[model samples]
Each structure stands twice: as C-alpha cells, then as structure tokens.
Target: MNLKLEPGTLDDAAHLAELRALAMRPSLERVGRFDAERARQRLLQNFTAEYTRLIKQDGLLAGFLVLRPQDKDLLLDHFYLHPDFQQRGLGSATMELVLAEADTLGKIIHVGALRDSDANRFYLRHGFVLREVAEFDNYYLRYPQHVPLRGV
Candidate 1:
C-alpha cells in the first residue's frame, strides 16, 4: 500500500481531529461517549506536532499517531486511522514499526485503548500487557524485546 509516516505540523491538527472522530466513532458509540465537538477539542488540547506523525498511503493522508517521550518509556497516544483504512493491516503495520523503534531504544511503550473497543484485542495481539482498566480506557504496556516480531 506504500504506507509512509510523515512529520505532523500544527496546521494538521484540524485534519487529525476529524480523522480521530471518524476512527473512534464506533468504539466511542459503544460506550455512549461519542461527542463530535468534544473529540475535536480533546485532540486540539493535546496535539503536539513534535511527537505526532501523519500516516499516508500512496501519498494520501490515511491516519495519524503520537508517541510522546516519558521519563522511562514512551506514551503511544491518539492513534487513529480513517475508517476506510481500518481492518486492512495498516494499523498492525504501523504498530509493528513503532514497536521495533521502541525495542531498539530499549524502552517500554504505553498505550490505552477505549473500553469495549477492538483496539483492546489489537493491542493484546501485539504483545501489550494490560496494566490497568480505568473508567473509560484500558491501559497497556509493552516492554522492550531485542528480538523482532514476525507477521505483525
């Protein structure tokens, strides 16, 4: 699919917000928390161009993800793919790429999936272990492994 990740810019925040809404709608709806305006606001409030990356497929914007550095690990946040891009292996491929980078740095990666979302299964399948389940999200952590994974 010629997937690529480009550095994000402040101007991309609005587009990323829309993408986030589209990607999280199904999961958010399942938990009665789908609010369009709120979603946009949240993305804007936390958007960090320095850490965000826009995902493109064959040169078209397809999704975005942010990996923020923590004291001893990395926080994987706001990972969203356009609805059309989901279930097509793009997300898994993206995760694998990030996981490889984390392993290379010998740092743990933390991620949170919304409750009742398919993301939970996706993260688990990728070797992320559950660390906690909050009211609205399930937190996970993947420790560094020197060996690379196959068939992600």
Candidate 2:
C-alpha cells in the first residue's frame, strides 16, 4: 500500500482532533455517547505530538496513531482512521509495525477501545487480550511473543 508515517507536531493538533472526532463518531454514536466538542477536546487533552505519527498512503493523510512508552509497556493510544480508509488492511498493517517494534523491545502493549466498538474484535484478532472493562472502555494487553501466535 506504500504506507508512510510522518512525525506529528503540535501544529497538527487541531487537524488531528478533527480527524479523531470524525473517525470516532460512528462508534461513539453506537454507544450513545457521541459528543462532537467533547471528542475534539479529549484528543487535545492527551495529544502528545512526540509520541504520535500521521499515517500517509501515497502521500495523503490516511490516519494517525500514538504509541506512548511507559514504565512497563507501550500504550496504543489514539489510533483513528478516516472513514474512507477503513476496512482496507491499513489499520492491521500499522498494528503489525507497532507490534514488531514492541517485540524488539520485549515489552507488552496496552490499549483501550470504546466499549462495544468494532475495535474490540480488531484488537483481539491482533493478539491483544482483555485486561479490564471500564464503563466507557475495554482495556487490552498484547504481550511480546517471540513465536508467532496462531490466528493472530
């Protein structure tokens, strides 16, 4: 797919926030929690340009992701794709890259998806195991495995 990543900057915050809101609308609406302003504010609240990258396909913005390093594991935060780009293997490709990086560091990756979101199945299919279920989200942890997991 010729996927590429560009380092994100604080200047991109507003744009990223817009993208996040658009990408998350369906899931949030499905869970009866869709709030336009809140969605943008939430991304701005935790946006760390240093830990984020803009995904590009053929030199166009496809989506974005944040991989924050923590004391015990990497956090897979803010992975959102444009509606036009979903269900085309880009998300899986991005995860494979992130997982490979985590494997090299021998660290687990933690992620939380909106409750009842399609992301739940996506994470599970990528080897993430459920760790917790909060009122608004479902937390998952993917351990670094030297050997490939079947069906992962």
- Cα-based TM-score, every candidate: 0.94, 0.94
Model 2 per-residue lDDT tens digits across residues 1-152: 99987899999999999999999999999988999999999999988999999999888899999999888889988899999999999999988988888998899999999988999999999999999999999999999989565697
Model 1: runs farther than 4 Å from truth?
147-152
Enumerate residue pairs that collide in model 1: none
lDDT of 1 by residue, 21-88 (tens): 88888999998999999988999997899999999988989899999998999999779999988889
Query: In angstroms, how far off is 16's CA in candidate 1?
Result: 0.4
- Scored by lDDT, the top model is 2
- After superposition of all CA atoms, the RMSD between model 2 and the true structure is 3.8
lDDT against the true structure, each candidate: 0.92, 0.93
